[model samples]
Target: MTSTARILIVEDEPKLVELLTLYLEAAGYACHAVYDGNHVDEALTSFKPDLMLLDLMLPGKDGLTICKELRQHSQLPVIMVTAKVEEIDRLLGLELGADDYLCKPYSPREVVARVKAVLRRYQPQAPAAASTTSGVHIDETRFLAQLDGVTLDLTPVEFRLFALMTHSPGQVFSRDQLLTLIYDDHRIVTDRTVDSHIKNLRKKLEAVRPEQEVIRSIYGVGYKFEEGSV
Candidate 1:
């Protein structure tokens, strides 16, 4: 993540905002803050932050609703911070298009790390390092993807994740590692967001080659791709 990256902190507690600002600023992020959910949009427009650290329970509007509405037009990465530990709340937040969620009573350092992780993922980097993997080929220059000579329609995230795993066939990539392969550290997400991406990518691969299992999930580990002997 760039040191010039801007961060918007949304929370009701003044002390928490101060604490976060202290840590985030030290980590080289410029931060703007809002105490109520109602002020989120105005701040978003004016601040134009690269990422947002949103508190789930706010005085007005609330995080889930704000997130849902934001997803309608913005791709800004949001990391929801909340005290709610319920499984449903986490699922709801993810469903609402939050990039990641952070449970409250969290560490300031972890918050900074999450901020870096999400921003790193959000920012566009150079194209895939390696192009071809067996029958699957990616034309980074033309931005084309093909599975066994058939064009594959994939989202950008799916494309990058696909490129990473296929580039290193048979090598394992844990969820976090896959999220930021360009880096060795940084926990991008706590949940199985990576699994959902892998699932979608597998479906696409399945459509072209029904009998071949190109992507393999290792139990209790992570995911890897197999070229399956030319």
Candidate 2:
């Protein structure tokens, strides 16, 4: 498909932004740039980019703060770019609602590919009737999930994992397998990243049904969904 998708690059490094813009534009996307975190809102309102490539640290507002605030009003897909390699940093970024994460020294081409993957998966599909199975209900068109009829505020990545695991019930999905489903770019994201997602997913699920632990870790193997007895 010929893409006219708009992207906002939020990076303090001018050269990096230029490189990303070069690659993204080459990949058939239109790109705008914000050099500092403070200017993100202005760009979002004026440029109306379909996606944002956000830097973790900046002069004014940090990426995490911006992401948390943005999620309050918008569900625009986000891919966090950061220099920090710590797993906790990655978890925080994801927990703050980032769609994907990229550590620094990343390939611009790969970033472009990730942008395409996230955008492709995130595109709204035809509204389907909410289907309830195994005690969970998800609306594809709405990108909404409900447990015990309580709405879940799930990120795209979280939603995909929840739906896949819930659909299979008892099937154990290894980290690699789960990563393949959530992140299509085939990049090297750490195990903690996967754990972070599972942790967040469980929290959201438990919020709705506090007594039941639907998703259980299988130690060294992976994780699976089990409809616990109530």
Candidate 3:
């Protein structure tokens, strides 16, 4: 069994914070709860949580600011909790480096599941023997994607999605499959989410290499990375 992971909960509401803490601890994970934005930096440095559950509206500093700040220093996974239903808010959080977001009135069990899923994706481990010889170079160390001297500045999600496709080029992945790969809790995602990310990834790739498109969209199925060429 995997060891218990450390988590930090940053929600201002005493009742909700306490509830989540209780649920997470019951799940056999180490958890720290903070009720203000002022303590976030200190908690991040000292607690060193594997993942953070941040609420958007907080006293002192807002969650978006904290998310942006954390991204500058660490790739520690973050899941934003917000009561806001605006799509703009959701897009802003994701664009600012949050791995996921949970709307208000969420189940503690669902939150726990999301946490586990995110950790599974972002946590690093020793590479498998076969992966080393797969001829697909995904340099986690450099946060870079390269093929025949071409390089791209892929977002964390984009990089992961690209790596998945490139590892087995020509293998088509349905929208549902891509959603599962990109999000820890696929239960909260939609097919349009996959479409948006793919569009973003394509735009980023096109910025770097104007002549080529590495990802291709199928009319009725999904997407596949073009194979047989660099």
lDDT (Cα atoms) of all candidates against the true structure = 0.77, 0.83, 0.78
> Model 1 RMSD to the real structure?
4.9
The residue ranges of model 3 lying beyond 4 angstroms of the native Cα positions read 92-94, 128-136, 140-144, 147-153, 184-188
In model 2, which regions exceed 4 Å deviation? 87-94, 228-230
Span of ten consecutive residues with least summed lDDT in model 3:
127-136
Candidate 2 per-residue C-alpha lDDT over 78-125 given as tens digits, one digit per residue, 9 for 90 to 100: 988778777445555457888887889888888988898889887667
Which 10-residue window in model 1 sums to the lowest lDDT? 182-191
Q: Cα lDDT for residue 67, model 2?
A: 92
The TM-score values for the models, in the order shown, are 0.66, 0.90, 0.85
In the order shown, what is each candidate's alpha-carbon RMSD?
4.9, 2.1, 3.1
TM-score of model 2 (CA atoms): 0.90
Angstrom error of the Cα, residue 168, model 1: value is 4.1
Error of 1 at 200 (Å): 6.4
lDDT preference between candidates 1 and 3, better one: 3
Error of 1 at 210 (Å): 9.3
lDDT of 2: 0.83
Q: Between which residue pairs do clashes occur in model 1?
A: none
